[model samples]
Each structure stands twice: as structure tokens, then as C-alpha cells.
Target: MLRAIIVDDEELSVKRLKRLLSESKDIETCHTFMNPLEAYEYAKSSPVDVAFLDISMPELDGMALSGLLLDLDNAMDIVFVTGHDEYALQAFDASALDYLLKPVTAERLDKTLAKIRKNRGYTAAEPALSVFLFNGLRLCRSRKGQETIRLRSPKTEELFAFLMFRRAISREEIVDTLWSDLETDKALKNLNSTLYYIRKAIGSGQTGDCIEAGRHEIRIAESSLYCDLYEFERLLKQIRSAPEPSADLFKRAEVLYTGEFLKGKSYEWASEQTRRLEQDYIELLEAAARFHIGIHQPQQSLRYFCEILKLDAIREDISHEVIRLYTELGRKHEAFQQYRLLEQSLQQELGTRPDPRVEDFIMKLMR
Candidate 1:
């Protein structure tokens, strides 16, 4: 087993990472520390195959600690764990092997471990391509949790997204969806060229029969890809199928919705899917809000309520809920400000006022 060490200022973060690493048989936890100085001293005496370091630690950060660790053992692999995306380039600049975002998924961590194995001359499994459809279309091929390649092309990206949702479709149907405005013959030619580029962009040989085209229909082979949209849908299906929805299931669903589906994309075919995912996201947030409320966790409930309000500011019920939470938490000024903002937003956007229920609640609270 590959011996590994973890260092994070947050105790919970360290525990979470250790739990995740425990699931991987290929890795063994050698040591864990919440103090960077102690970790530094330990590293000097103990040799480890890999070190997972948190970037934002007090006094000594991951980047600086990495330099010190490398000075001890130049062959050691360092993986930076961070909550911020801004530190990605810097993490790589420090000659780190990989970086994982907060709330790291097991699937993602497996890929990171595979990378470390590959560097050590062990044969590693092929890493899956992670497709993020929420914020534009980003295709990432990763090994050991570090992005090896990112594929980008507007029309090809759109075609990939369209195909991912449908799985299989006739070339004629694709032509109609993406290129209906163009002449039939021209559209067919564009479709052919776009398919060629898509396969090339995604690595036909490496990805292996991921996109297959036959005499009439083109389909994406589902087994070869991992998509956020597909994963989100799967989680929703699981929750619906479960006899009793657990807190873990709802939290899992919440994490899948990193952002709005296909945000900033304006394909006619995508509009419906976009709206459906948005509605699902809002409902998930609402359910989480209720779940937290049921458990008497007002802070958590208010967080979900605020997220929902961000999507639909005029949601009177959610606004009322936020106000109530603020009042309960003794944040009276914030509660009053929230009410005023809602009142102003309604008058400006819809030429209306807060609902009578909201008005009454505000009056009672203000008194």
C-alpha cells in the first residue's frame, strides 16, 4: 500500500479526507495533522509516498510546506487540497502532482490515486473524462485528480451536450436540432465535420468507441463517460426510488448541482432541459430547507432559503422564512433589511408589494 500523510488546519476536513482515503485499498494513512509546523517536523523524520496538504492553513500554507517537504524528499508526490479554484494554477506551479476541490468525491479521489501509481511505474486504470455541463461545457480528462487535458469548441461542445442528454439520435434529428436554419445538404456536411472534430477533440483511440455512428443514428456510449448532468439525474432517481429519503441522499443531490445547467448556452433544444434542471435544483434546495427546519437547525435552513432566494428573489414564502430565521437568531437589523429589499424588489420589478402574510410577519417582528 502507498503510505500517505494529510495535513489540514480544519479538524473536520482532515477527518473527512482520512475517511475518503480509507476507502482506497491502494493507499494507507501514515499520519494526519491539523498543525502545519508539526506536520513539517514529522515529514522530516518519516518518509511517505504522498502528502495531501491544505492550501489555506495558518502560518505555513500548502505551497510553502510543499517546498519544505520536497527538500526532505525530492521524489515524494504532493497533492494540494483546497476549497478555492483560484489556487489551482499555483498548486501546479509548486510542482504538486494534483489538487482536489473541497467535498472531494470518491470517484475523483480514485483518479488522483491512479496518477500517483502511474508515476511510480505501476499500471493505472484509464481515468474517466469529467464533463461539466452546468457552467458552459468543460471537458476534463484527469489522472490522479489533476486535469491532463481540457477540450473546447463551441459547436462541438454543443453537439456533445445535445448528444449526452439524448444518448442516441438520428443524424437527421441532430441536423434539425443544431442546424435547422442551414440548408439540408450543408447541415449534413457540418454534422459530419463536427463529429470528426468531436471524436478528435476527445481522443478517439484513448476514449475508445465512446461516440459511435452507424448507418442512421449516432449515439454516445454511456459507459465511457461521467457527466454531471447524468449523475444529477441518477441521484434524483435514487432519491425518488428510496422508500425513505435520508439526509445523506439530499446532501448528495445538493452537491451535484454545482450551478445552473448549461448556463450561458442558448440552444433552442437545451432551453427545456435547462429549465427542468433549474426547477429540480430549486425543489432540492426547498426540500433541504425543510429538512433542516425539521431538525431545528435554523442556520442551515436559512442557508438553503437564501440560496433559493438567489434564484427567485420574489419567492415570498422563502423571504418570510429568511426573515423568521434572522429574527430567531437575534439578527433584527438583517431581518429588517431583508424585508425592505424584498419590498423594493417587488415594487420595481412587478409593481407589487409583499404578500399580506409577509407584511403581517414583518409588522409583528418590527414591533
Candidate 2:
């Protein structure tokens, strides 16, 4: 996915452009700012593939911002969007890859993206490294008409995963985490050998560059690899921050969370991340449930609530929500069954009764 930032002083224009980009499904908006100065500051700290700038804003214009952004990262691509047609020459002079006239059309945006992709040597059809951490650890590089490459190595895979998790780590940390029992010199030698095997297993062409090792530290390049965990967390953040959550966005994010992070793995360091992501997944389900209910979609709400209960059966509030939704849908029998399950779970797990509010709701519903 192309990481992009959109800058527009106008809120409506920014929303419209974001909607269009979302529909395209190729660009991921890392940040959006009404102030060009703030956008420039963000671009300086983050790796952005493209900057979509609106030219007529006060304080700082898009053309000026493009120069600043390019100064920070000469490799960053810029596309100018403005209402004024005459600014096209100025935009090109500022080294913009493309100049877009205001009231940007989808077709025009598509053409502009095509130009950017071509100029950047980005092939939409290139094989992408897919790392699966939800069910178990699996790595595959996939391309349209080519055979998939499956990467396999126990120690090397673990090393790669550890680096991906930490982003960067000192050699001492690597030895402590992955080879703690060995002597310091042996651990250091093992780390180097494992890294070499990792590079070889994942293919030295692109994946080799992803793991950078210095004399003292090693880091996984964020831009050079794609992992499901990364995407899952990103989508969760997007869903949480959306001004108005839609069913489509919720569903898009929901699908990315296939299961718990590295579900079957017992890596000590992964346990905390696994639990955190599981909690976030449960919350996402709860958010979807509430959103569906707000929209008067009882069945959809029930579906999400049921999923939440599956992950966190002892959450009395969610259990109550499930019961309420089932009752709302005239499935009183199922509602009672859910209540019984909740009561049984609470009693078995905590040796306590259901919360008073849940009991009250059940009693009232029955009457």
C-alpha cells in the first residue's frame, strides 16, 4: 500500500478526497492536516510515499510545502491539488510528479497515481511478502502468475519475528531474548549465523535488505516488509479515529483480524502483544456491535456481540448486550440461553452471580 498524507485547509475537501482515496483502496492515508506547516513537520518524522497537497491555503501554500517536504525526503513523491489552473506550471516547477486541478475526479486521480507509480518504479503486480502471525507463523511471497515462495526456518524465522516485533534491537538484547542459555561469544556467533540463514531463507533480493544489522544493533526496515499484525493494528487505529464509523470500514477491519496474534506460539515476548491485540480485537467487535445497534441492525449487532462473547465470555456487559439484541430480534429463547451461559460462566470462573443490571434486564425481559 502507498503511504500518503493529505493536506487541505478545507475540511470538506479533505473528506471528499479521503473518500475517493478510500474507494481506490491503494493509498493509505497516514495523516491529514489542515495546516501545511503541521503536515511538513509530520512528513519530516514519518516515511511518506506521497504527499497530496492543496495549493491555496494560507500561511503556507502547497508549492512551498512541497519544497520543504522534498528537502526533508528527496525520495518522497508530491502531487499538487489546486483550484487554480494557472498554478500547473508552478507545481511542475516545484518538482511535483503531477498537478491536479481542484474538484479532483477519480479518473484524474487514477491517472496521476499511474504516473507516480511508473515514475517511482512501483509495479502494482509485484509480488508482496505476506507474513501470517494470526494462526501460526507462516511466510509467503505471492505474485499474480508466479508460484508462491514459502519461507521456512525455525531459528531464522524466530529471529526475523523478534526483530519485526521490536523494530530494532541491540545484539545483546537479541542474544538475551533468543539465545539466553548460550555463552556470550557463542550467542553472538549464533545470532550472526541465524541472521544469515534468515536472509537466505527469505530471499536476499528484497527481504535481505529488510533486516539491517550494524555492529551493535539490528532493525527490521518497516517500509521493506509487510506483516498482518502491522496492518491489523493500523486498521484498528483507523476505525477508532474515524469521524463517522461505517459498516464497510468496520467490516474491512474486522476481516483483517483473523485470530489472536500468533495464536499457537508460546514465545515469551509475544505473549504480551498477543494479549493486547486480543483485547483490541474484542473491543473492535464491541464497537461494531454498538454501531450496528445504533443503526437499528439487531441481527448484525447480535453477530458481533456473539463474537465478542466467544473471545471474552466473562464480559457481563457484552453478555447483556447479546441477550438484549437477541430479545430485540424476538429470539427470546436464544436470549435466555445466552443468559444461562453467562450465569454459568460467571459461577464457574469467578464463583459469583451475574451483575445486578444483567439480572434485572433478564427478569424484565421475561416478564
The number of the candidate with the highest lDDT is 1
Q: For model 1, give the RMSD to the true fold.
A: 14.4
lDDT scores in order: 0.83, 0.81
Residue 292 Cα positional deviation in candidate 1, in Å, after optimal superposition = 1.2
Candidate 2 TM-score over all chains jointly: 0.71
Q: Could you tell me how far off, in angstroms, the CA of residue 125 lies in candidate 2 after the best superposition?
A: 5.1
How close is every model to the real structure, measured as TM-score?
A: 0.63, 0.71
lDDT per residue (tens digit) for residues 1-367 in model 2: 7889999999987887787677444675557899998988887788999999999999998888888898899999998988889998888899999988877765567788888779888666433466667767767675221344444456776787788788889999999999999999999999998888878877778767777889999987655656777767766756665565679768877887888777776789999988888888888888998898888898998899899888888999889888887887899999999999999999999999999989999899889
lDDT of 1 at 93: 95
Off by over 4 Å in 2: 1-51, 54-127, 143-153
Backbone clashes in model 2, listed as residue pairs:
none
Candidate 1: what lDDT?
0.83
